[model samples]
Target chain A: MSGASRQPNGSHAGGVPHDDDGVPGPGEMGGIPRGPEAPAPRPPVIHALRDAGLAALVAAGLFVPLVGLRTDVGPAGGGLILRTRWADVAILVALVFTGRLAMNLWSAFRPAKRPRTALRAAQLTRIGTFVAPLFLGFAVLMPLLPWTTRYGLDLGVLVLTYVMLGWGLNIVVGLAGLLDLGYVAFYAVGAYTYALLSTTYGLSFWICLPLAGIFAAFAGVLLGFPVLRLRGDYLAIVTLAFGEIIRVVLLNWVSLTGGPNGISGIPRPSFFGLSFSAGGEPGSFADFFGLEPSPTHRAVFLYYLILVLALLTNWVTIRLRRQPLGRAWEALREDEIACRALGINVTNTKLTAFAIGAMFGGFAGAFFATRQAFVSPESFTFIESAIILAIVVLGGLGSQLGVAIAALVLIGGFEAFRDFEEYRMLVFGAAMVVIMVWRPRGLVSTRRPSVALGERKAISGDLVGEGHG
Target chain B: MSAPILPARNAPILQVRELLMRFGGLTAVNRVSFDAMAGDITAVIGPNGAGKTTVFNLITGFYKPSGGEIVLNGPGGPKPLHATVGHRIAQAGVARTFQNIRLFPGMTVLENLLVAQHNTLQAATFFGIGAAFGLGRYRQAEREAVALARRWLEATRLLDRADDPAGALPYGAQRRLEIARAMCTNPVLLCLDEPAAGLNPRESEELAELIQLIRAQGCSILLIEHDMGVVMRISDRVVVLDHGVKIADGTPAEVRADERVIAAYLGEGDEDDVPAAPVEGAA
Candidate 1:
């Protein structure tokens, strides 16, 4: 859109697309009120050629220094000398020129996309309905594969952890329409809760897990109080501040959090009081079950633990959508003023959304602490919150299955390209830009009503409110 | 004794006394006062920007009055609506429609109705947790809620499209759905702002019938309308406001004849012959 806007107005002619306000005839667009779908007056094939040529020229100019030339050490002890690689520059320019030309022509000639409607959205979601169960089944059985490696199990646990976090934040951002940039704060709370309890009080992970969620929920309520009246960007800014506040507090609160050094050697969760040691101790998991000793046992157990937790989050979220409170949250998102007229306590609804979302974050945090046996303020940064938010938004806000898939792709994608760590952010950024351009609403953008008296239909994404809150 | 279906007819449902609202230097509604009796349609007729909606806002608790009070005479007796907050006004048995339609557009039509009765289910579900666990009691409450929603959907003629998103409903249907959604809150007083604004004559006639039907159900109607044809025919009583002042309050016929009310309308509408609409058995 920005590129389209930047072009000289008359240059668009008939070939360029405008927003579909009713279709306008071709020649009227240059001067009259223009729509993106205005009919082409002329072929504009010449304009396309000019635009593509110009783009290629710019690409060549940029590539001349960036790719066409390289510097090498001149002799062992001396300065550098220039090496020309015009072949590389020519290939890059040719690719850019053709790519730009193809994109321009495709966009120009393509029929206008159909307006989203409930029936169409329902048809799109039918595909997801079929695919989701198959994906869930695959996830459940993947750990049981005969060639499953310990690294693979750990990666599964990691991806599942993000999936849980994404599901939790979905309640706040997607369902309630509250954009929370501070979700990772709750995760930090849960991790620190387990870390401090297990390291200080010698409490088991089982006991500390619930406490972590409770504490995080408590923190959620605390954050919810002063910001109850804020909405939209104001709400987002406050939540962002809240996230930074938690991180800074942890960084400075030396006596309790150990400052920047971080707490380590946090105890791993036991399998119902059975340790995972290979010492053949009586309480060891292998000893109790009379199985051969292998460290894979602990990894597999951790994988299953997080898997169960993630599934529980998904299940509870699905159930809550049918509940009155959940419906109110959605209503509030659609129109807060209307919610007020309908006699919904906006304060209570927003608070519950925050608290519940934070509780899940806390649960995930405890899992993180137990798995890594380490806790640090550095682990709970704004980046973690951004990544989690990206997953929710990219997954189509409230879509449960979409969130799971997005989490898997994002977290697994990050780990899979570990060899190219330097370019990881670059690839991620490009992917985000491409996703935003292609599908602004998200990958799966249908919203199924929590309860329906008639046959259920998926509401089109355009109808759903991007909650001001 | 066989009971009358209407509850306590002719009792005062809403009373406004010296209702005032000010935005900065402008006094939107100044010293407006009126009473709507139960089982009656009270149409508030006024010129544009004459503070009709300002008065409705004060009564619905959307805006805190600069001065004066609005009261709803609930079954429990007169409760001060002006003192309560927004949702509290609805909880106190007062509900309103926006001048611009404000439905939960993303939700299905049935879901919009269900949201209107949120207070009941919220309590039944123990504020959201019990229902999450599939509690037994909430399921029954939910069934009752759905039944109630279906009844209203049937009333509004939206039953066939219950599963469609509210945003997709035709404009006239959306207006009817807004009224239905408001009634789902079970308010004694329903305040409608310009309910028939964009309706064609046929649709407006249907709206008049719906309003009367609502009145027959024993709920008081407080309406702000620009369509004089619908206003004069359906309202049992009409209160005229011009520039934030009530110029006349009486039966629709009386108010129509009042010279002051006619002058306020700037003689735009011939006040005398609106009643020819819905003439029975006319050839």
Candidate 2:
């Protein structure tokens, strides 16, 4: 019980005391100077130019080697020679200068007031109800559209995979308030499970899917046992180490996992018992349907399959949010001390969150393996974990729609810039910085409570902790 | 498991015997002993750092005593709490509030009470599947839980702000909500640490009335308060502590008359010595 007692400083620290008289603080006064005597003073243009010039210089220095300079081996197996992409450097420098200039102007002229949470909540509700459905409908019809190319289908699959991963991570990090930096480990477990089971035992995709989720959940439980007492950054660091351990094990375990060569020619999921193969056995999808074989059929089927799984994940998560366990998860987030005082078993609550979140990651990983028809340690890297985490953060933690939107904007946007090659990551990094600055909490920061007693007003994210459990 | 043992009638609901707790070289609670009778309001009063909270932490299983036993007398005789954890102690029918209010600030006022009844609803929810499916058993439990929460809210005069976040309530109201939340566990014994610490005069008066009401509703109360007025008016028995040791224990009038109790509060100086009767009235 002494161990069960909350960390003494944990609960009460950083709590904003409620003022009985309802007088707003200086920062909450709509950002307008009250009882002001002085007129507004804008920054001088020369100052703005100086700030922009500094930004340009820094940008030039950073990009000159990474983007501006490239080393190339001489044509025939000769010594290396320097190759410069001056155009790339100039484009980057100009972008930085213009961005800095705009920021300076906006800082000087933009309204001092923070946007009203009420107005933002209303706008989000409108978009959530109207625009969100339209986007979902477009996703549903994406493969069926007349103009869809194979490349578009492939990109769609990639985007959806990350979307599912982001949503899965959201359950642990966003909803449960556990900062897991090693979520990709569970994804790897699921992928490897499918790879090993289907290839060795000749299990079908349907049979192995549930097994993958279970195995990943077991891994989650194993990780949960030793780390239940840790909180915040300590918990995050352990999870990150766990992720790396899983990756390294998968890399070196050659006998079972095929070493670095990876498990390949992993079978694709069939349309029920009907294979999507062309030469068409009696049970092949095309022969059974009495149609000519087409590669698009399998691609479209895979799209629909993943769509159902992702949607099911979303549906189950939304339902879990209202349950006692879900409330316990959130309560644990708000105050673990209070939660224990309320007679909650902290260990059980945390384990459930980790296991469930990891379960979804497992399902997504299995889908990924089947889609690619390969399983490799290379795919489950720390950067992949970082990207999925970015989606959750950029979307607003604990937000379902936000995660989806973030995945689309980040993963989809990255794919859209594929032609930029090395420059794409540069743009990607810049866009991430800009978006974070624009919305620090996230793109959709307002929280919609799972249950409400009366009118369900969305709460401002300001009141919520930054995912502490 | 062994056979269940029944307790004698009219026995004390809680017993702390020879409790000893040491932190390094310092003994925070040393050889303390007390029996809080059923259906009675017992108050523990002391100077700052007299280990009043440390004692509460011991009984509620926040800390394991270095030496001693805390037993809760249930229908099945005394249950030793030395082996129990905080949540288990709560399940064994002892509940308490912190000296600093520990309400879930993010949760609505009513939700705070609902969380306190987590074990009951959690059982009905069948590990969350029943709740997810909105089964009749889960819904019924939820209805009863909400009803109980509303009832307590009404008693605490917090019904009007039931949907407001508990953290947004005034300091006094947050204290009341914390008490209400602890009561929602439906414990046989309720231990409150400094329940009147930050309350205004009117709020303290109302709190005195609420304590009586809760006691009348069949829950025994053990309170720790620095406010002598509330302690004297509401408490049927008083236990005084000084420097982690019990100094006095008796009826309010009896403890008020103890010379050691007077000396503990006042100075040990000879000139400050006075008859305890006038001091009680003055305090």
Interface RMSDs of all predictions?
Answer: 8.9, 5.8
Which ten-residue region of model 1 chain A has the weakest summed lDDT?
A: A1-10
Worst 10 residues of 2 chain B by lDDT: B274-283
Model 1: residues >4 Å from true position, as ranges? A1-40, A53-96, A108-126, B1-7, B272-283
Error of 1 at B120 (Å): 0.7
Candidate 2 lDDT over B1-283, as tens digits, reads 1112324435688889999999999999999999998888999987778999899999988888999988899654678987789888888778899887777776678778888888998999888877777789988988888898888988998876776667667778888899999999888889998887776677778889999999877788999887778888889999999999999999998888789988896345542343122112112
Q: DockQ for each candidate?
A: 0.38, 0.32
Which stretches of model 2 miss by more than 4 angstroms?
A1-109, A112-120, A467-469, B1-10, B266-283
Error of 2 at B80 (Å): 1.1
The per-residue C-alpha lDDT of model 2 at residue B108 equals 73
lDDT of 2: 0.83
Tens digits of per-residue lDDT for model 2, A379-404: 99999999999999999988888888
CA lDDT, every model vs. true structure: 0.85, 0.83
lDDT at residue A227 of model 2 (Cα atoms): 90
What are the chain A TM-scores of the candidates, in order?
0.84, 0.82
